[model samples]
Every structure is written in structure tokens, then in C-alpha cells.
Target: MKLSILALASTSVIAISTAAIGQEQDEELRFGLGGAVVTQDEGYKDVGSETQFVPAIAIEYGDFRLLGPYASYTFFKTDSFELAATGMLRLDGYEQADGDIFKGMEDRDMSFDFGLEAEIDTDFGEFGLKYTQDVTNTHEGYEATLSYGLPITVEKGRIVPYIAASYASEDLTNYYYGVKANEATADRTFYQVDSATNFEVGVSSDWFFGQNHMIKADISYTSFDSSIKDSPLVDKSGTFQVLLGYVYVF
Candidate 1:
């Protein structure tokens, strides 16, 4: 199954872009180095929370932005609205050490996704919508998301709290979470997962120091749908993730 990491990373990209668009002036080119610590389920049965430290990199030039495995290009922009094409490298699947339930299951390889997105800046916050398809044929399915972000300024920094809802096609969920008959064991019976909808609420904050240094942090909670929670491969009905890091822009 696609973890919360990718989703949060994508959201961060949008948040940063939203802030940049409001600025009358910005660096022609900027780069940052940081990292994140994520707490997530292993997406399989009998697995506990897994914590991982991942490199965090951000690059931006004009209307283009890149953050880790996610990238986007703002093709059209105005004071209240913006349109962009987005892509992401989905890091999913599991290793043997994850759990015994996955001992005989085939690995779900990472895949590339391409899609279009639009964002609207309103008096209340920024609203976003996106639709993406798996370009690698790994799942032969699509996913869509709707979200809103409200930014609150504190001192020299800003805090953005957002809420999002997502939908995953049956093909996508099954491909990643289902248990095939041939691979099922005595403890894990064959199972199938249908299209599912999930919801997320998160808050991200960034504190600036000078013109080149900043610290960022984010926390989020996700509630899975019955379609995914019912799967024998999944042990948890929800997940919570946290990210904290620093960046240097040049």
C-alpha cells in the first residue's frame, strides 16, 4: 500500500509553493537539505510501527518545485488560482523481515505516477484537487485527492494546518494489499480489497532564521476505510506520521 510519507511530501510541496506564490520576490534558484523521521505501519499483518529516517531535499526555480521523490510544475498562475502538473515516485511494498504473513508474498515494486493538479487561494485558505494515474502499469489504476490548507503566521514563521480526503481505485488497493490465493497460507487466507477512501488532518510549521536557514516540522493522522482495514494484510485501521527537519536555502 502507498504509505503516508508520499502523501505528506506532496502536501508539503504544495504548501511551500502556495507561500512562494504570495511573495512578490523570490530567489531564482534555491536548494535545501534536511531529513524526516516517519512513524507508519508496515502495511501487513502482525507488523508494528516502523520508524524510518529519510533524506529531505527541496529545489525550486520559478514555477517548478521538487521535494524528495515528488515534483511539480506550475503552468498557470494568478493571484487567486494556480494550475500544475505533478508527479511522484511511490515507495511501497515490504521486505521479509517485515512479518511472517508476508513470507511468501511477491514484492510490490515502486512505481511512478503522473497527474494534474489545481489550487485555489480563497479568503479562508487554499483548496486543492488532483487526479493521478500509475504510469508504470504497476497498478493500472488512479487516485484522487481534495484538500484545504489554512496558514497562520506566528512571529517570523508560519503554521499551515490542512485537511485532506483521498480515494484509491480497487485496482490500486488490491494490487498492493490483496493476498493472492496461491500465496495465501494457513494463517493468511486469500483476500481482496476494493476501492477505499481515507481522510487526513495535518499541521506544518516553519521557522525562519536569517534569509537562508529554516526549521520545519509536521504531524498528521490518517484514518483508513473499511475496504483497506478489513484486509487480512493490514493490522491497523489508521496511522500517524511526524516529520521534523532543517533546511538551508541558497
Candidate 2:
């Protein structure tokens, strides 16, 4: 079966974008749905993960936000853990049989995906959980994140600094870092699947330079464990991302 893991990977990115939008306490309720083009470096520098188109939905009631109930024809959900283990074993056997031991000795090939997130307000700020599922037949895995926001006062506007940590379950870490045969490239038919764990720490600032307008900058470090540490699939070992958007709170 051809695994649609790409769909799941893409979903993870979408979940982030969904949480990026600002929220308000006075509003009774609100809903939104959107998508973005994301560039991921799973582990390869020259060969980054595929550019994906991901979409999501969100509902907000006062201080709480739920990321989905929204659906996409492009993606689907499935069991990630079971699939990931099976994929690892398959890649390991494929490598031993082909006897082509070098770069392609592991199964690091993965896919894009779609999923959901739910959050609420607290004295500390906002807290939430996110889950994403793979859509392929080869390997499967998902990513889950927990975060909190802290608000500080500034002369010009409100500066909100947020901290979040995410875990890409064993299934996910192994799939993207796993090994398998290179039937697609006509190289060797053997490969190994590497188990991986990705952790990220970052801060974000929302500056109200003017009404309904804000400036945002986010910087984070994402690292992986296992042989994938040396794999070429990673695009950025350490990176920074900045974004600008308009936020209107009623």
C-alpha cells in the first residue's frame, strides 16, 4: 500500500498556522478556515521535504479556540503508531536484502498530513494541544504540542511572549528518519529506519504598532535524535522565521 504520510506532515504545519491568529476575550464567538504554503526541511538541506498546501478550520468562543471539525478533501486521518512500526521493520529488511549499504541505508522518506488543535485561556495565558495524522500506506506518525502565552505591558502596545514545546511521537520520528529501498531512484534496494525525537523551544511577540495591526517574529531551534542526526533530510538545524499580519479584536 502506498502510504500517504505526506498528508499528515502537511497537516502538522497547518496546525501551527491556525494557532498563529490572535484571539480576544470580549467576542462571543468566531470561526475561520485557511491554508498556507509551507517549506519543511525534515532533515535534508539540498533536498528539503516537499512544499505542501495545507488548510484548516477554527472556532472561537470568548477565550477558547478549537482548531477543527473542519474537514479537507485533500487529507485524511488514520492510526499513526502501528503504521510507523511496520514501516521501520520493512525498511530494515529492504536494506539487508539489497546489500546497498551507504546513504540510503535508512528509511527517512515521509509525507505531508492534516490534523487539529484545541486551546483555552488561563491566568498564565492560553494553553492547548494539537494532533496530526499521516495519510499514506508506507509509514505513519503524528506530532503533539503543548503551549502557554504570557502577556507583558509596553508603552506603545501589548507585547505577548509565548513559549511552546512539541513532540513528534515515536511513530512520526521513526517514519521520517526510517530507512528503506531506493526503488524510486534505481539505486540500492536496502535501507534502515532511524528512530527520532524532535523538540523545539521558541518565543513570539505581537506588537500593536497601530490599531488592528501587529508585527510578529518567532525564533526556534528544532533538533532530531538517532541516525537521522546525520541524515541529509534535514533542511535547517537552527532557523528563524518572521511574519506580519493584521489582527482585529472585537
Candidate 3:
């Protein structure tokens, strides 16, 4: 479920730009339907690499946008800078059946996060910074991200490569990776973890074909933080994800 959530978030980035490219014109709207395949390490014991197919949709209207479980509205903007409010649904953690060590552990439900974002475009690339908090009380924590994106033009399309680093508050990391006293067993002892940071690097490519038709693809790798890696439920320290889809602009 964590990976699925991340997969959806990744697509949001590629789709959000659809409307902004021509914001100076009349209000624009675009809808896209596609599929994505995500491969990620299970953040639990006894669980191995998992892959799943998911439906993908992108929507944009004026300053409002919806990309999967993420939504945002641009309230201030300029030719080279913009500020927006954002929200997203976070799905992470695991169920008891997910692993032997989690046989009697409680499930971590989905969370709703709200945040603010600032972005700037320069000759070097686009840079962004964002901060979010879990309003749903699921984690009752905050997260911050810093990212940069650079686009390269090809004969028939464009490719954007991006790199980012994120910080998760202690409550967020502990809620997902820590072992509670009640959840501990003879073999699995209770554990607590602190805040941590992670990094990701990815590339997205879009190729235009027949009128208003295009294909998009992206691939990324993420490294987990030590706080998350040292958990009794974790097996791997990183994850790799890939997405491919098609879109049409009106």
C-alpha cells in the first residue's frame, strides 16, 4: 500500500505541469487515463519485492489540479515563481497478514496531509520546497522536501530529470516503523525510532505523436533512512519504481 501511494504521488508531478504550461491563455483543462507498474520493497518482515498495476488519471482546471491522491491550488504566480497549497493522501505501514512478525500488530490507516509549496524556475532548472503536516492525526507529524528538476529537449519530445531529498518527523517514522509494546513478541521486541531523511532521483519523458496525443514514462529510485532501515519489519533499504502512460490534451 505504501508503494501504491508513492506511485500515485509520482504521477502527480508529471501531470500537474499540463495546465501550467499555458496558464497565460484561457483556463485550460486536461484529462488523462493510463496505467502504472510499481516495484518496491515491502516494509515488513517476510515480505519480498512486490509489483502492482494501478489505474492513473490526471486532471487540471485553471489553478486547481488533481493528480491521483494529491490535490493542489496555485494562489500566487509569476513568470518564474509560484506558490501553492497542497494536500495528499498517504497510505503506508502494513497489515497483520503482511508478515509473520506483524501477526498481532495493529494496522496503520491512511492519512491526509496538507501543506504549502513554493517553486522557482531558473536557467539551471526548476527548484521547489514544500512542507506538510498530517491533519488526519494518523501520524500527527510533518514532512519537508527540497527538489530540483531539469528538462532536456529531444527531437520529438522532452525529458525531465529530477532529484529530491525529504525529511520525515519522528512521529511519522515511528508510527510506520516502530514496534509498540503491545505489538512485541518473544522474537520481536519493542523499538522506537526518530526522524529521518531520504533521497530520490528520477527522470520523466514525454513524447508527442498524433494531434494532442502523447506518451509519458518515468523511473525513480528511493533510498530509505537509517531510522526506517533499522526497523524490525524492514528488509530492504531502498525502492525502485517505474511508470508508463498515455495522455491527450484538448
After superposing all C-alphas onto the true structure, candidate 2 shows an RMSD in angstroms of: 10.1
Runs of candidate 1 exceeding 4 Å displacement: 1-27
Tell me the tens digit of each residue's lDDT in model 3 across 1-250: 5545464545544473463344345376666655555566544666766666666667777888777778889999999999999998776767777767778889877788999999999999999999999999899999999999998989768899999999999999899889999988888789898999999999977777755566777788889898888888777777666666665555
lDDT of 1 by residue, 132-160 (tens): 99999998888999999998999978999
Question: Per-candidate RMSD vs. true structure?
Answer: 2.7, 10.1, 2.4
Candidate 2 structure quality by residue, lDDT tens digits, 58-81: 455543445432232212223321
The full ranking of all candidates by lDDT, starting with the best, is 3, 1, 2
In model 1, what is the error at residue 118, expressed in angstroms? 0.8
Worst 10 residues of 2 by lDDT: 81-90
Stronger candidate by TM-score (1 vs 2): 1
TM-scores for every candidate against the unseen true structure: 0.89, 0.49, 0.89
Alpha-carbon shift of residue 140 in model 3 (angstroms): 0.4
**Between candidates 2 and 3, the lDDT winner:** 3
